[model samples]
Structures are given as C-alpha cells and as structure tokens.
Target: MGRDRANIRVDLWADGDWRGLSMGAQHLYQQILTHPTLNYAGVADWRPGRLAALTKDRTAADVQRDACELTEAHFIHADDTTEEVLVRSFARHDGVIRHPRLHVTMANDFAGIASTDIKEFFAFEIQKLNQEQPELALWNHPKVQTILKAKARDMKEVTQRVRQEEAMTFGSATAKPMAKDPNSVSMRTATATATSSKEDIPSSEISDEIPRPDVDELLDLLDSCLLANGTRKPSRNKKNREAARLLLDRDGYKVEQVAWMIRWATADEFWRANILSMSKLREKFDQLKAKAGVATKTPSAGFHGEIDVEAVLGRDVWTPGTPPEGLDVAGEIAWKKEQRNIHNAERLAEAKQKLGIS
Candidate 1:
C-alpha cells in the first residue's frame, strides 16, 4: 500500500556534482533509520546482524552521500577546510613524496582506473588546493581527523615499546664482555705489525713527502665507489680511507686531523692500521696526479684556468710569478729573441720588395 515498494530514488550530490538519481527508497529509509553513531567513530564492535541490516537496502549513492556528509562535518570545525590531510597521511604512511599513476594504482590496488595522466591530474589538483585554499587542510575532514588521531596514539605506543626494547638489549650486550681467547696469536701479530709500521715511519717523510688529493678528484672517486656499492654502509668507510690517503700524501694533516675529517670512530685505530699503509697512498696519489696533469694540458683546461677575472685585471700589480717568487727572467729573454727574429724576417722581405727582387 506504501506506493508499491518497487519504485524509489535517493538524490545525492558530492563535490557539487550529482552522484546518481536512481536508488531504492527502502534502502534509503533503512540507512537513515538504522545508521549507528558508534560505528561512525570507528567502533566496529557492532553485531553481525545489525551491520547486515544496515547494508541491506544500501545503494552506491547512499554510500557516497554518507561519506561526503561525514567528511564535510569533520572539516567544518577545522581552521583549514580545504587541506587534504588524508592524502598527506597516506603519503607519510607509504613513505613517498610523489608517485606516478602506476605507483598509486599499485599502492591503492586500483581503487579506480589509474593512468599516468590521472596521477598527474590528482597531483596537480592537490597542489592547486594546497596553494589556493590552504584553509581546507585535510585535518578539517572528520574521517581524516579520526584516522590521524588514532595513528598518533599508535605511533606513540610503538615508539615507547621500541625504546624499552633497545635499552634492554643494550644492557644485556654490555653486561657480558667479549672473552679474549688465550690462543689467538694472529690478532696479536696483526696488532704488533700495525704498531711497528707506525713507529718505523719517519716524521720528516710523513710531513714533507705526502700530497693532498685535489677535492674534485676525490669527489669523483667517492661518487663512483658509492654507485658501485649501492649502499651507504661502505660509503663512509671508503670515504675515510680515501681521506686518510690524501692527508698522508699531502704531509699537511696529522692522523688525528685525517680521522676527524672523515669522521672515523677511532683515530688511533685508523692511524695504526690504515694511514701506515703509505705504499697504497702513494699509488693513489700518483694516479690522481697523472690524471690532473693530463686534464691541465688540455686546451679547455688552459682556457678555464686563464679566464680568472682577478688575475687578468691585476696583472700589473707586480706580484711574483715564479715557483718561489717572480717570473723567470731567462725565459722572458728567450721569448723576446724569438719575437725579434720574426720582425727581422719581415724587414728583409720589405727591403727585397723595394729592390724589385722576385
């Protein structure tokens, strides 16, 4: 008798667009009458029968409308209404700043059709909203706010647990000292050799013979090594070794300085075992020096070195140009003699022309 239950529709709109006009009236009535308030707050302890009853007559329109209204109410009380805190929260959870469509699809399991263009579209939309309507921060949305609050509480508990575990593990490890094996002669020999090598190296040789690696060359080598390793663990150790070699070669840095520059945990240990390996240091230094010499000989390198604004402008300031002081007077004199010979040849040609010689 109630208009023959077959025909009914629920009108719903989201983001200012009509979602759909076709929905069963009975479904709409059931959703309104049986919707649980506790469930909205994420208390999912509802009995199975009650949940089934609530979904019995539900339509896509009903779900969309409810979602929109719930979101709007949450954001209504926020200082920033347009903020997409939900998207931000999702990104943080996933540990990515931005992803292409394929990534997003994989992450969300194709929540909808995902294409590269669609990903770009969403990214652009988010950027525009954040920039133009920052007041709509995602924290304003009820669903996002609820999720964020729960996440915060969970994170705090997790952090506390982790700290407690770490402390206990550290205490146990420290309580038992590593027992020294009475029969370990190899380690003793190695330590003895390292110490002897350090003592045998003369101070004057260490100070006067070593040369520092050029910063650019060191950087390139580090980059190559890091790329090959594909991990940060070896990178630090490699950097320390390279720095020690450079300082040892330059004769300018002490072992402590080398350790400090490379951030070694134990400067004494590094000096004892590593810096004393001066033969390897010399090899690396020679290779780097040869490469630098070749680069310096190239025309491009010459041009780059000669184009200094200060040098060109200050050429007449009477600064010494020699290795220890001013330019070589002998070299200057030889260059002038060559110029004079050229001038004499030109004069002889002019004299021949005046005499009408062929």
Candidate 2:
C-alpha cells in the first residue's frame, strides 16, 4: 500500500555519507522518501522533468543531476528507461521487511514495478534482510524465490550483452566513449606562452590622447578568439588597452591586420599561450605577421582577404616565389604606412579643431 506517512531517523543528519551529498541531492532524497505516494516496496515514479516543473527556480537538468548523485551515493537506484527509482533501504528502515504481515502488501507493490534493474536491486535487498533476520525466514518464500528467479534471468541477459559489447569495441569496459564531433566547441589546447622575448618587441608608444573605440572592439575580439581556441580568457586591463590603441592609432596597424593576428596567434600551436596580452600582441606584430607567412605578402589575395600563400609558395615547388610578379614588397609596406600616417594626421587635425586645441 502507498504509505500515508513516512518515518525518518534524526541521526541521518549526523551520517557523514548523507551529509556529503549535495544539498540538491539531499533535498531530492528526502522528497522521494517522504513522498505521499511512496509504496511499501520503496519504488516510485521518477519523472525529473515533471517534478522540476512543479519546483521553484529549478530546471529538469538540475533534478536529473540530483537523481544521478543520489544513485551514485547508493542511497537510491534509478532506471532511466523505466523512469522509476528504488530506495535501497526503504523496506528495512520502514519496518516493512521485519513485519512478515507486510510481505503481502510489499508483493502487491512489487507487481507495479516496471524496471527490471530496480526489481533486481529490490530482490538483492530482500535476500540480505532474510540473512540478517533469519526469524523472518523469507529466503525460500514463494514471493522471494519468484523475485530472485526473475533477477537471475536479468543478470544473465546483462552478462551476455556485456560480453557481446566486449567483442565489438575497445572501450567495452568504460561507461561511454569520448566525444568526436568535429564542429563541437571542444578543442585540443595548443601550446600557450605567458612571456615573450622583450628584445624582439617593438616600442608601442601611444600618440593620441584619447581612447579609440575601435581598439577596444579589437581587444574584445581577442578575448573571444582566446576562448574559442581553448585558452583561458586573457586579461583586458588599461595597460593592454593603451597598447592596442597605440598599435592601431600610432603604429599604423590596420584593424583587420590586428584581427587576423589575434585569431592566428590564439589558434597557433606555439603562439596560442605566448601572445596572451595586447602589449605582447602589439610589440610582436611584425614577428606574428612574418610567422603567419604574410610580412611582405599582399593583404587582399587569400581566403577572406588574408595573405595569399600561393604567392609565398611559388605556383610550383620548382618555381621562384610568385609574389604577384613585380609587386614591390618593400614599396607596398612603405606606401601603406605613409597612407596610414596621412589618415591619422587628418583625423588628429579634425579632432583638435573640434576641441579648439591650437
């Protein structure tokens, strides 16, 4: 019969294993044990999603996690396919097993259990109860024998299935295989560098007195790229902020160039950990561009307007570096720098004029 009332031990709080359970799991355990419809057999419906809907500020995932924790702790056994739970100690603790008169009631409740896994667990507990209290003498009872025989078949099927799985996969002993989805966010952590050779760093001096909004956007992009590359989030304090501002505003580095460097450095096996800060990024921009195989290469020739590698590596391995025949590599760099200086001058002049600065 579904119990109208449930008994709880006060010493339960003092139990180290019980206290070790997460508060959510502990709450769920109590909820299940005290449920008004909890049957004599300790088996009950375990619908995490439906239970979550009736609770405050808890999702189905939270309930599912709690259920798993309880199951792992051996406080309960849950069968996902059957959506049912068997509280391991319910019958013994509730005095049902000790009272031989209650066996009929327990058998009636057992008939309603749909989970073979739960039935197996329940039968094992009954055998233990019989040994602990031989006076009850339930070991050879018709009901106990029937439950044991059913679980025996269940165990045989489980053993056969495990054997078949072992014949199939290398990880048959493991619970599950690791994820292999290519497009998933998970990625191998490439090497990361926290320090760079200071001698190789360029002087990053900011000329503009005001903050550049575009530079801040570039810093945000760098942070996002770092996370995407499976690296820890890089810091974005004012020191790095000013460095990026100088890189774009005074050093003539284009926003697109900085964006490309940010992505390449974060994804590169060697550079991912090293160029973690904007100061490092700005100081070693030329080195990064060269390592990226684009120091003297034209910017607008490759996939999505990046460096054209075909030009770097000639049309054929035997041919000389193509570089877009007669493309003045040095002249191009100088011209771009000169244009950026002119643009910056115009922008500075406009700002000064607006601010009435002589």
Candidate 3:
C-alpha cells in the first residue's frame, strides 16, 4: 500500500464473519448475545464463509488490520429475542474506514425484531453517533437532506394556512353589522321629540289656563253671613268687616244663590242671618250714619241713614283720616239707594205685623 493509514479498512465480524454493519446494529447484536440462553451457533457457522469472501478482495495484512479495528469499536447491547441485522459505515480518528456489524439472535425463538422498532433504534443510534463524531457526514446524504427540507416546507405551509384562516374569520366577525330593527331609529326620535316638547312647556301657562273658584271670596262671604246671624262672633277687625260688606254690596247676590255657589244650605241659620241681617242691618246703618254726621232728609220710609259708601264701591273708598272725593261721593249715593230699599222693607214688615199679617 502507498500509505498504511490510508489503506486501512475496518472489518466488522459477527460471530466470525466479516460483515458490513452500523454502530446501532453492532450495539444491538452485542445486547442480544449477552443473554446466556441466546443461540449464536448458526450465525457463527455462517460468519467464516462471509469473512473469507470479504477478504478475497483484500491483502491478508489489510484485512487483519480492519478486523482488529472493528473489534475495538464500542458495542451497545439490545434486548434478547431481537433478530435483525444492522450495518453502517464510519471513519476512525486517524481517517481509517470502519464498518460496524450486527448479528441478532433469538433468546427465545418466538418472534423477530419489528421493522418500525429497527428503524427507530437505527435512527436513535445515528443521532448518538453524529453527536459523538460530528465530522462524520452520513446525514449529509442527498436523499436525507431532501426529505428533511420537504418536511420543513410542508410544516411551514400548514402553519401559514392556519394563521390565514384564523385571521380571515376574525376579520369577518368584526366587520359584520350589528342587528338593528328598522323602526328603532324612528321610535327613538319620536320619544326624544316628545320629551323635549314637554320640557320646553312653562308651568305658569298651564296654571293660568286651569279654571277654579276664588277660595278667598267664598270664605269672606261665609264669615260675614255667619256674623250677621249672631251664629258667629263679629269680626274684631273693622277692616275685615268693611271689606266683606263692600264685596256683598257690589255683587248683590241673592241669599239662595250665594248659598248654592258657596255650597251652603239656604235653610242654614248662619246663611239666612248673614245675607238678610235679621238682627241689626237697620240699627247698624243708623249708628254709622250718626257717627259720620250724614243727614236723613227723606221723611218717607224709603230712606233711613248714611250708607256704607266704601261697601257700595266693592272696596274701601276712603281710608281713616282721608277726606271723601268724587268716587266716594258716587259710592255714597249708591249705598244710600240700597239702604233706602232695606229701610222701606223694614217699615213694610212693621206695618204688616201691626195688621196681624200671616
């Protein structure tokens, strides 16, 4: 040989045969043979002829050196009852060729190693071998490189498709319109308009249009009527009496009419006394006229004393210490005319009683 190192080729022997084998196969064979009951007699018998044939192509010295190299390589044991052969090619640290061998024996002659198990075992061993001797370029073969690349591309395509589908679904959901009934907008607008109109209406306008009776006038009439009958005490305030008298004189509502409007019974003593003055209308008029120095010029019973001038005007025509004016004179004239009727009625009643009228 030109160079002994270059010419060196490792020979793997199974039992005694020079077989081409893998590191995984060698480890598996060793594991099988380690079982005490495993039979290797048939394999050992077949090995010598195979070894002889392998060496026929090589010089004796080279073959012997290769066999020695193979023997020195590490061996891993597999379980007994495994019957298969595995082989691989590797290089030594010094660049010498080493072929590993596998010889599987059945510890109990039941079954052989499964193809999937063999393949998985081989793959694991190859990975280990690559780790141990990274410079070994077995995984760099074209077929293995092509298969790995194809698997990577297929995985990438599958991932991209899944992401694209997910994104499309999400976009469609977000873009979908919210459900709205056709009439909802119109209803909302109508409600809002009604609410705004109600808010804009003023309370004062509503109050002014609503009709009700004047409570003050009704109450004053009740007080005056009750006092005139002696059914209630006379009002202590002169102003209240004057005010009530003025209101009644100006309106001249009939007793029954006043009672009906004020929801009082005409038969009630207080109602009859206040409006008709059954007690003292005549006497009171005379007293007031005397105090005011008003003269009763008529000898006829139609006229009596000075009238309540302010009472006829429907409000006070003169204040205390205030001199009478044109309006007061007019009010006095009207009051006098009303008093004359009352005095004539009284005189007529007296004349009727003298004649024993029923």
Candidate number of the best TM-score:
2
Global fold similarity of model 3 (TM-score): 0.16
Which regions of candidate 3 deviate over 4 angstroms? Answer: 1-114, 144-358
Residues 1-358 of candidate 1 have per-residue lDDT tens digits of: 0011111123323422223322332233233323332111111111222333456663232332332232222210000111111211223223222323323222222122112222232333334434555564453544333322321222223223333332343343521221111011011112232433343333444343344444334434434433332212122222233434445555554443322222221121211111112222332333323322222322221122212111222222231222323323233334544664565355434544544543
TM-score of 1: 0.15
**Model 2, stretches more than 4 Å misplaced?**
137-141, 148-358
Estimate every model's Cα lDDT from 0 to 1. Answer: 0.28, 0.58, 0.29
Candidate 2 per-residue lDDT, tens place, 60-146, comes to: 445655765665456876654354677888867888865667776786677667666677767777666665777765545677556
> Residue 346's C-alpha lDDT in candidate 3?
56
lDDT of 1: 0.28
Q: Which of the two candidates, 2 or 3, achieves a greater TM-score against the reference?
A: 2
User: Per-prediction TM-score, please?
Assistant: 0.15, 0.43, 0.16
